[model samples]
Target chain A: MNTADIKNEKSVRYHGVGISNGCVSGPLRFFRQRRKMGRIRACGDQREERARFEQALLRTREQLDTLQRRAIREIGKKEAEIFEIHAMMLEDEDFLEAVQGALDDGACAETAVERAAEKHAQALRSLGDPYLSARAEDLHDVATQLLRQLSGERPDGDLSTEREPYILVADDLSPSETVTMEKSMILGFVTFGGTPNSHTSILARAMGIPALVGVGAVSEDCDGAYALLDAAEGTLTVSPDAEERCAFEEKQREVNDLAREHDRYLRSLINKPAITRSGRKILIYANVGEGREIAQALLNGADGVGLLRSEFLYLSMDRYPTEDELFASYHDVVQSMQGKRIVIRTLDIGADKQIPYFALPQEENPALGFRGVRICLAREEIFKTQLRAILRASAYGNVSVMVPMIVSEDEVRACRVILNECMEELEREGKKFDHGIEFGIMIETPAAAIMSDEIAREVDFFSVGTNDLTQYTLAADRQNPLVERICEENREPILRLIEMAAEAIHRHDGWIGICGELAADLHLTQRFIDLGIDELSVSVPYLLGVREKVTECK
Target chain B: MKEFTYTIEDPNGMHARPAGKLATYAKQFDADIRVHAGEKESDGKRLLALMSLGATCGTELHFIISGSDEEAACEQLERFCRESWGRGE
Candidate 1:
């Protein structure tokens, strides 16, 4: 099947990766870059040409500033920072000197800017860092804006000029260009080249628009042609015949109706308890990072926060966050939960997650190196400070303290000793805090799960971090793509470990929950329930769906 | 002239954002600041030049400040390195 012929023919189906979720049909318009630049007459004097380049730079700076403000209003601060970086690149000394060098050689302002931009972009590309090398594309984007300002060309990819909403077609859209477009004018997005993880796909998902990427090439002749896009099926049909159009419309109606009904049904289950048909009640909880996510968890009908990673405060600061700062943040989150249990996992850093202030040693195998409980144990002051804060916050609500990467009962005992010390210090200072705060350990390693029978006597409960338990048990790094499938296919060993942990914890009169990717795996929900798992904690979006699945479990 | 040495603490090294920030901050005074990363040297006011050093997290950066305001620049730059660069934020 020839792609070009299909693109130009009637009722041709093109396939690409689908993003977000929706179905729509509208006129298709091709997004083209403005390459035809108007040349300014170069004077015989070098100074005059240099001045012209300076003016374009100034205008480009002003444009970027305006775009930054617009992006902040339309998108968010983090995304808008792209424009801020662009502004800095525009003023880079090396870039300026390169442009000036081109001008001294008597190149016109437009040509000089293009040449300078390419030179810097090339330099960045050769740096061999994937992150920094990606900045090369950003350099080209900034230069394009400067060139457009110099040649007095209209902004590239400005969809606001289009009168009606249309499906957008492009080879690929840069983050800056995508954000600057008039969003209302976009009915959907079609790209000939891009991955599902591209910024265009992320923005499309954020806007809740149908998008198809890597659909090969759609001809410029196809612009303004009526087309139908079904993102759920990852298909874009150009010039759909009457029959195809009718079928597409019916499918679109079904999709829309199904979405609305599903949302309503999930919302209806919000306030109900997730009791299995076998008469076993399971707690449905949310996994959150910080205080900011409490509202989202509440809205999604989470019974409690099962895994509240306490790394957010430490990771964002330039220094060891004071005990008061940590306490205040924890207090707010605890109070917001309104008596619901929130398990605050102590700083699970060192592997993948690094903070510069920690000055952690470079590890040959960080996964097996100093991390989680080991780091907390080595740095007793940091551990004590965090423990003190969590204990103080427990006064306001139902709070549980969970330690990660515990491979032995000795580590649990050490943590308990420090926890006790902190409690004594809090009492001495007359700080009102809950005396009976629940303590727990994450069964994330094979050793921890195997020894759970003994460790269960130390902590109040166990929440299996299946992500690590799977990796550690199978001896495969899940982050390695080649070995990832092994971890997925080898869930039996992980489930068996969870079973061991569940049985051990129950024997000790303690409860067990799962707070990993496996927790939200609906396919394993019934199996987990059969193994006597008592709780499932997932991210906020999956809370309602998991709740519904729990009721279906026998 | 006043001089000081500080080690890079950011896992990302001297990437564009921090380099740009350092350059912007260096433009405040009449003193001339130079950063030496082993055999490579870069003007403290030049973002691209600083990034070109490709200094990784543990690389030491030697700073030399010279001019009429060398005293103030040295004190502030040392403070900046301790507070900002040391934390790598």
Candidate 2:
């Protein structure tokens, strides 16, 4: 059928959640699941059922051995070991015991294998290890192979049989299946079912491959058809018309060019300072979530880390992370930064970033009530532990402590008292730390902005957290659709507050920085420089873009 | 039987690389090896089992080996723990 007829037949477009950024147009290679074989109930005899299972195991082992070798040559040694891991899991004594136990209980070999695999899969998943949980997929793969062999079903076709690099369209894929593929031949992934948090989603994101998940079924007639898999928008257009194909190709090229441009152009800017046309040198720093993001920030040419949101450590764990655990993570980040400034925001939780262990009381307005510095000031032990950890990390790098959501000079003074006490404790323990490490406050409230002149005198620096400042100043919820215009039209008020904070911090010979989404806004780059803001910190991805914008600005 | 304990030093804990290498190493000897981390006990020869222990940084792992080559297994695996495991910290 022609493109016109194909477009009219059934639904040509499928929608799903995009896993990563990118797009691809290629032949749709459907990863067909093996059709169910007729189940022949075993005679409830031990010998016969055992024989069937043993034979199935033998077949599976041979098949895996061949696949392992082929995969080694195709993908490389490291990825090929996935097959080897599967083989070891297949023959593990504990797993075999479960499988054979079910067979002994008169269940057929197929059901027995499925039940055993599910149990072990569940066990692995409960471990809370992302990689180990990913191994649960290996269990399912091995079990399916064994089941297929027991009923004398043919194995799935080799992807190499296809000539072109194909977009893998499937009902679903286990992490094992996703990793084991010849990643080069796989253009992208489109699955009929998978949530954003599914194992396949994790794999796709890790692999940096474009993927669309939860796209409903495609008709068999459309198999092997030329399709556009635009994961940037999470749409699959099958048998696209000439115009659609041309448009998709253009968009794909734009994405590729921009990605490559960011790498090549950004690498050149890494060692150079971000200087505006008028010789105003702006320090472009990064706002990172955790320690791992620090490495990427450094790679992207961050002058330093302006906002290390320390709440992530609290969020990722069940209970409060021990001071030692927190110290280890912070130390690694500090050591890697190599004397660069790392302004760590101390536990900006109790707002949207809630922890169940903290048991924060439910409020009508969580953002305004019992949050940030207020919570930290009330929960002395938690605040002290974090302060101690930040102090310890200061020994490794030029680490600064920043208090979030401070509305008064009193709160700043109180934090300084705790800060000095932490220093005293560290000193008493004979800990080698930077005693002169700068302490700062985040100007995130209208009250904080109003009182910036007084607050700046209490701290060594000021970082205007514009996201919260904007919302607070305009009295409009950022997430509320009805107040979009209110937030949109209120940029001038927030900038004026930043100007006040910058001026206040400057009066005391202290540096002021902006570490929020507004820092990445190209239009605001010039105003920030003109306002004498010392540093502008956005996320890692915007490090170069903001730097480029700064150089372009007068 | 011969047994020894080693603490996890890697911030990533007993992830794929260390677990896979530990499994491959444990399989070479004629010994039955078991590793206990917290409440989880894993067959040392099984990669997934070793990883399933969910041993984070500073987790103490006790390796128990029995059979013909228990002594050799302990010596080599202990060295592996010191050298290969918990690197890049």
Candidate 3:
């Protein structure tokens, strides 16, 4: 069909899995599978052999280096670091030996490199460590690039076809790859492999892209066939009929209208407080991880930072950040807030976030073990360093120290004792600080929430970490898709805990803040407001929506 | 090396706002001036690089001047990083 005819054509029956959000009317563009290069032939002449090997190595390094630099520059430092492992692998003696061995065996360079990579990959896979297993994709990417370069094949450019309104179908997409795609032309994304916790999924959510992953053969089956993706339902249709398309289009239009209305509402409240008609004010803060996020949060009209995860400072560093390193970080955050209250949570690393330098032993149940205040208590020196840094920064701006995962009064008291010691030490050093800095505890565990009244009397504030609260209360892993129904935020127990926690804090004349997904939930915003949450801290993207909801709550 | 003070005009001060401003301006000059706040000192060019200094508003900090355009660089930086007269509480 001609371009004009296709633009006007409404009856073309094409099907594919939906990958991103929004609806667009345009011609379909299919992604071609990456071609694999075959083995290289062995050269009898040593000179030719050496030249070919060096050329291959240089070419592979250039491609990998370019990808790494681009990833770092465009995506982020974390995503860029993923390529460093591949770069190291290329220089490994063992890997080079394997490639050489393949060349010696009369195999083509492409086949030799692929064979070497496959063998090493098998060995790595057998080791079975999650950290190492995650590197498997890196290994694959490097090997593929080497093979393609050696075999004289050009590396594929980003999926930048001109066909508009195409649903991207893939086996899996890295965060960098996802960012490279034409966001406007891409309607949605469907993948055969990915988890909700995956960075790809997180980015998709941030971009308001509707993505369905773990759908087997959906991509292949629906290629060139029109399909409907129901992201809310996590379903992908293949070769959907006219009725289905019409229904989805209608639904998309409804969503668009709502979003437009939301945008208008958000624009109206750009400089306004999240106060109801009854004159009740709600402090809408932003949950920040890095320094860059602070600017984004303030721009989105956040009153201040509700939760500044200090883990990023340590995570981004190669080793444990020295006292000075920690001090600099805290100072940056405090200055960024510009006199606005910033509740800095001490390193809550454990479970999914592991620091290699600390060498924390693996726990049978990381969620319930050796994390948050527990880890801080055991590592007093590290904890003290963080506290000192926080105290030192407090002089610069409004800063508060928050303890995470406090399951008992003793843990809270123990943390307070250490914080007091840090304060004393800072006093001895003749440093200026907010001696009466507000202290808070993250009510993540049910035990902590149930005993909120007791904890509230000791601390100045409480921040509900609903992500962990739901996981702990429901005893369902948030990462597990099968247990998703059980781990819903609107569950009766969750609401009850939130209500009780808010009440307990209010009884003590202490404020309660929520720094979790539930805090940003528009549907539950009014309910939370009614429950008497003093503050709602959410991702920067959802700040406007939450602020609008707060205004409508009365 | 010469040391001078400047008022931070940006609302957020030396953290993200003034640091970004400093980074941009520093990149334009041939000489480098290291902005110091607390124990942190950052090369005046990079945004993430300059923010590493952690300078807050109303805080008097030292800027070590060296390099080719050190005199002009210090004057501009001191003016920017310090609070203006009657501006501070």
Assess each prediction's global lDDT (C-alpha) against the native.
0.84, 0.81, 0.71
- Alpha-carbon runs more than 4 Å astray in model 2: A1-263, B1-89
Interface RMSD, all candidates in order, equals 9.6, 13.3, 18.1
Share of native interface contacts recovered by each model: 0.32, 0.29, 0.00
lDDT of 3 by residue, A287-355 (tens): 886787788788778899999888878877778788889888889889988789999999898864577
RMSD of 3: 24.4
Candidate 3 vs. true structure, TM-score: 0.55
Q: What TM-score does chain B of candidate 3 reach?
A: 0.70
| Model 1 TM-score, 2 decimals | 0.56
In terms of TM-score, the best-performing candidate is 1
RMSD of 2: 21.9
lDDT of 2 by residue, A220-241 (tens): 7777888898888878898887
Best by DockQ: 1
User: DockQ for each of the predicted structures, in order?
Assistant: 0.13, 0.11, 0.01
lDDT of 1 by residue, A264-287 (tens): 788888888899998999999998
